[model samples]
Target: MEINQWLNSAWFWVGIVLFIVIIRDIFIQKSHTITHNFPVVGHIRYWLEQIGPELRQYIVANNREELPFNRQERSWIYASSKNENNLQGFGTDQDFNSPGYIFIKNAMMGYNPPVNHPSKKNPGVLPATKVIGLFHNRKRPFRPYSVINISGMSYGSLSAKAVESLNKGAQLAGCYHNTGEGSLSPYHQFGADVILNIGTAYFGVRELDGTFSMDKLKQKVDENPQLRAIELKLSQGAKPGKGGMLPASKINQEIADIRHIPMGKDAISPAFHAQFSNIPEMVDFIESMATETGLPVGVKSAIGKLEQWEELAAYMAKTGKGPDFITIDGGEGGTGAAPHAFADHVSMPFTFAFAKVYQIFQRHDLTDKIFFIASGKLGFPEKALLAFAMGADSINIAREAMMSIGCIQAQKCHTNHCPTGIATSNKWLQAGIDVTLKSERYYRYHYTLVKEIAEITHACGYEHPCQMTMDDIELSMGDNNRTMTLSKAYGYHKTAIAYEYFNELIDCPHLGGANARNRLSR
Candidate 1:
């Protein structure tokens, strides 16, 4: 082609346009140092950085190398959610010799329920052995139908479709869904029982000035029959002692309406509750809420200092008036956006934190009184078993539930760009989730998880997971092939309170409906 003809060609015109745009971006855009310094070539670096997580997840990293949720863990959840074959062929890839390794001590003769057992007929329907608020005599005390329930992941932090799917799934699976600290949005009303999590800002039941309002709380409870309980958020695992701030830019009208906050202004949650400053006052506040709402009241917190927990336990033991349940969140828990330092090092991990708090309550003889809930990565059957053995009456799962509904753990939760639509609120991104289909997926995941836990329980000669004690667990000490009982390692002896409760229920004719034989299945 002639030089004049080349200059007038389409390719030549495209090059000219690109060159002009690049020159303008290089000089005018000072926000990105690399692009400003290296011009068009630096664009390649940003693109690579943008997709770095995907490349590492799918191509570079091994199955177990990823953080938060590795390929193996994610695969198990995905397969379980889809009701696919999740059984491993070549045994575990775990390093048995590794220090801190834990495993359940299977009984020589596995437990076999009677042919007429509810579990045999309905598989995966393990109900709580103890009622949630029976001890407190709340106006509406009831036993939780499933031991495994969905943990809190706020509607604002997650998409509306995600919340709706989770609620529907919880309903199908006979499990409760936690309306996270963001408040009770319409999406959380899909016929599932809800534990309303009231954070420091008191989102759903807050006054115009962001203070907690008892009248508003009563109205919420009265309006939503599904609001079975309330969880006062003292702190979360991801950011202990740190309050949250929802940027005005991310606060849409829906969020503003749900949270009862004005739009176009930052919604700030202070580090501490304005209602109570000390343990006694906090107990009074909890009791007041329980009285007003006629529902069980609980507190969720990540452990740091021991003094506050000890004080709370001591006070509760003395007065017998406090939270009906206590949920211990581990430092490893995620879902909320947090500072790197706070997320990594602020609070104790679940096992250690739970041990400390459990010991404190045990010392006060309050262990059997309050419903103990465990959170933070207790999704898998083995992990969940360990938690129950450590004295957890129930377990809550957040990330695992999100994964079941289509989260790839892209870790873009804080960026409003989740690819699978579980985390992000962006309409285009959220359109990826089919509420009905994903809801079924979540149901399958929950049902399968509870079923597997029951299978493991029966293998361990136990009727229910809560009946397990630390004596049934062992951990490697990282010494010369040394092993230690979980009870000894944690420096506490877990009582057979749950087992005793199970026995009592089985003995009573009227309460037989709550027994393992009549528990929900399938």
Candidate 2:
């Protein structure tokens, strides 16, 4: 009787339930191949696979060992935004002896003496604000309210909440937010300065016939007193010499209405502009747009083929008709969606491209007339300082800004399933983002970055960032344990034979060098 009672207990029922579940998982579940082979044990593999990314980030991956962005980089951005303890306990995790290492040369005597300075005890100091587009010929050339501003991230590519947060942040930061090619939405009118970017698709300024509409452009500029400039997007770094596609699934009625395209259809941007094909036509288009907008009109491009740029510069010099500013996007720049090939192996990197473009414009004596905005992985102050030293009038921050607004770098931006509520249009995901809170983070991040730039400039003995020259930075060639100043690296030295070391051979006309070899081969 005792044996019978024990067998009929609750434990007997639980055992039976477990056995049934195991049997079903091992035999009945055909969807999972591993589960069929390993029975209940196979479920462990599925759970581990589900948590693999998180596991790597939290445990397996070290702070300095990650791609695109390391833990240290992300932590700095986050800590600076929150005003938290960002200082590391020990020294830097950087490999100082590594090849291709770059660093700024601090001066023994800074611009202002430490003895008389109020913040002598402190490590950071504020530098004078640098003005951009001052010499440009425009009815209202942008003075650049801030040297660091938000880069182009489209409305449709980002959620509405994200756009509003960014716009508000721009307002708080006293900077400008670029209205990307996705067209202008009401959320963009958050009392912030705006830059209207017109792409091949001509989103906001397109007519029913799919050509650029001057009337619409004029209306937008006239209505928005805060619309500071207009940027004509010839190409971006992510996909140079290629167009973009917005899948129908991502496009809603509001997006369709804004873009002036039908809903539930793949919105295609052509590879090249329809308004102009040749160089002369393109120049004419920019001049016409500047005249219509009365705001500084600029062209944004990713560097490719130095000869093509030379031709453009030469023509602009000849006609004196060109953009008031030029934004150079490096190949490493990020995009919401792009083809793998184009993103990986298309355009020149930022530092090299920036140096080449600056040399070309300087050679043509057009540098004084046009402003240069550099972008591509320039999230850190060191990188921005490098750009300023390389002749960039200003720098644009894109991916880092996204991180400030709560992007987890999931790399799922192409899909609408972004978990962070940033690169997604899904309502459920977007709900996770609190605009008010995130906007504060954006403000803090921008403030910290601008402050850091000033601090670095002061440390380098410069009164302002604009005063930073290539001479202030040094690059490790990693060949023969050699070091070269940025001026020497970019061939800005006084010596005539300095051109031999430059990568842009077209600019170097000296005989018996690589230029001569090219001529002989041709």
**Residue range 103-138, candidate 2, lDDT tens digits:** 898888777635844235323222113223345467
Cα TM-score per model: 0.93, 0.84
Model 2 misplacement above 4 A = 1-50, 113-136, 479-481, 493-522
Clashing pairs in 2: none
Clash numbers, per candidate? 2, 0
Regions more than 4 Å wrong, model 1? 8-37, 498-522
The alpha-carbon lDDT assigned to residue 291 of candidate 1 equals: 94
lDDT per residue (tens digit) for residues 1-522 in model 1: 699999989999989987986887687877888877777778889899989989999999998778898999999999999999998997888777677788789899989998877677778677777777778898877567788999998998889999999999988887889988999999999887789999999997998789889999999989987788899999999999999988898899989988999989999989989999999999999999999988889999999999989999888888889999999999995899999999888999999999999999999988888899999999999999999999999999999999999998888888888888788778898888899999999999998999999998999998889878888989987757888888899988776762444345445423322222343423
CA error at residue 428 for candidate 2, angstroms: 1.3
Question: In angstroms, how far off is 364's CA in candidate 2?
Answer: 1.0
